[model samples]
Target: MTESRCGYIAIVGRPNVGKSTLLNHILGQKISITSRKPQTTRHRVLGIKTRDQIQAIYVDTPGLHRGQKRAINRYMNRAATTSLRDVDVIAFVIEAGRWTEEDAWVLEQLKNYQCPVLLVINKVDKLEDKAELLPFIAARNSEHNYAQVVPVSALRADNLTALEQTLDAYLPEGPHFFDEEQITDRSMRFLTAEIVREKITRQLGDELPYAMTVEIEQYKLERGVTHISAAIYVERDGQKKILIGKGGSRLKSIGREARLDIEKLIDGKVMLNLWVKIKSGWSDDERALRSLGYDDE
Candidate 1:
């Protein structure tokens, strides 16, 4: 019998580089929330992919950003950098044709890790000229000695098989850490909050996405139906008013979209209750950050 192989793989990159998209594509499930907005993912989410003789535990971290103005930003940076320390393989995901100062900063941090790093250039499908890939790969490879460089379109799920094979090859031989059936380590309550937050990000204006977060106040399951009551936290009453909108129309729309996704997630009937609350300065307060579930540990 062939021995099973399992190891932790950390996916690291700057904000808006499609790190979450790549993890979702690899797991074949939407464990991480995504939006077009930068910093859409504010927490580290773990996704497990188990195949024949291989189990890859992938950590989808919040994008490492330069801003540490808010306590939440510090928490996110801590979360992203901490995941790199003990992983067996590090997948440094980046956009195919773009490099930024933030990306350079993240690369500098990767220098501290001794593990094999796979340079995954995501969003190749967006490149109009296919021949441009070789030069891009060549230039990128020269910057760092990656164990393997793979170009893939995470959005389109193109070249993922090769990427997966490369990851599988680097995984250390050992017994599987998680059972084959388990996809993620996060609980339903956590996922519910994330789903709600995703809806908020998608439904709200650009200015409001970073100011708000979802907290599941009550979660209960009875008679084949799940009931969830959540509070959306904002720093001020004005932000709260914007989220609630005229006669609460905006909040209702957010709830409607979130409910559909929650139902699909749990595969059961869902009754969702959403409330907007003012938590003034939660993002900047360490105590408030902890209360909002931003505990780095």
Candidate 2:
């Protein structure tokens, strides 16, 4: 019998670098919520993929950011940094041909780590000048001696097989930590909440997405259908008004989109209820952050 190999792989990068997209493509499913906006992912999500003799547990963390003025920012930073510990390999994902100060800051955090880091240059599909990629790769490689550098387009699923093969070589040999059938460690309720949050991020304009969060107030299964009631929490009454929109149209649209996705996720009919509430400075309050499920641990 062939011995199995399994280990944890932490996917870290600056916000909007496609860390969530990479994980979703690699696992061939969407376990993490993603949007065009930065900071769409606020928690640590685990996705496990088992192939024959290799099992790679992927840890998708919140994008590491320099902003810590708010309690939510601090919590997100801690969640991203804490995922670095106890991982067998780290995939430091970055965008192709684009680098920022935040990317450099994230690299600085990896300086002290002992694990082998694979510099994953994501979004290669968007690079019109393919010839420029080599020079860009070389420039990044000069910054750090990555264990291996793999360029991939997470959205287009480009060069992912090679990425997987490269990752398989670095994972340590061990038994699988989770069942082969398991795709993610997050609960269905958590996923439901995230789906709702993703809709808000995609549908709403600037500032409203940052000001609000979705909480699953009630989730239950009756007969063959799932019933869910979620609250959209905002810091002020004015924000609540924006979320609800004129005649509650915006909130209804959010619910419609979220409910469709939730049905696909749960693989059943779904009845979703959403309401906007004023949480009054939840993002800046530590206790409020904890109460809204932003605990780092």
Error of 1 at 283 (Å): 0.1
What lDDT does candidate 2 reach at residue 224? 92
* Poorest stretch of ten by lDDT in candidate 1: 202-211
Candidate 2 structure quality by residue, lDDT tens digits, 45-155: 999999999999999999999989898899999998899998889999999999999999999999878999999999998999999899999999899999999999999
Q: Which residue runs of candidate 1 sit more than 4 Å off their true CA positions?
A: none
**Each prediction's Cα lDDT score?**
0.91, 0.92
Clash count for each candidate, listed in order shown:
0, 0
What would the C-alpha RMSD of candidate 2 be, to one decimal place?
0.9
* Candidate 1 lDDT by residue in tens digits, 1-297: 988999999999998899999999889889899999989998888999999999999999999988899888899999999888889999999998888888889999999999999999999989999898899889888898989999999999999999999888888899998989999999999999999999889878485968898899999998888999999999888898889999999999999999999998888999999988898888889898898898885
RMSD of each: 0.9, 0.9
lDDT of 1: 0.91
Candidate 1 residue pairs that clash: none
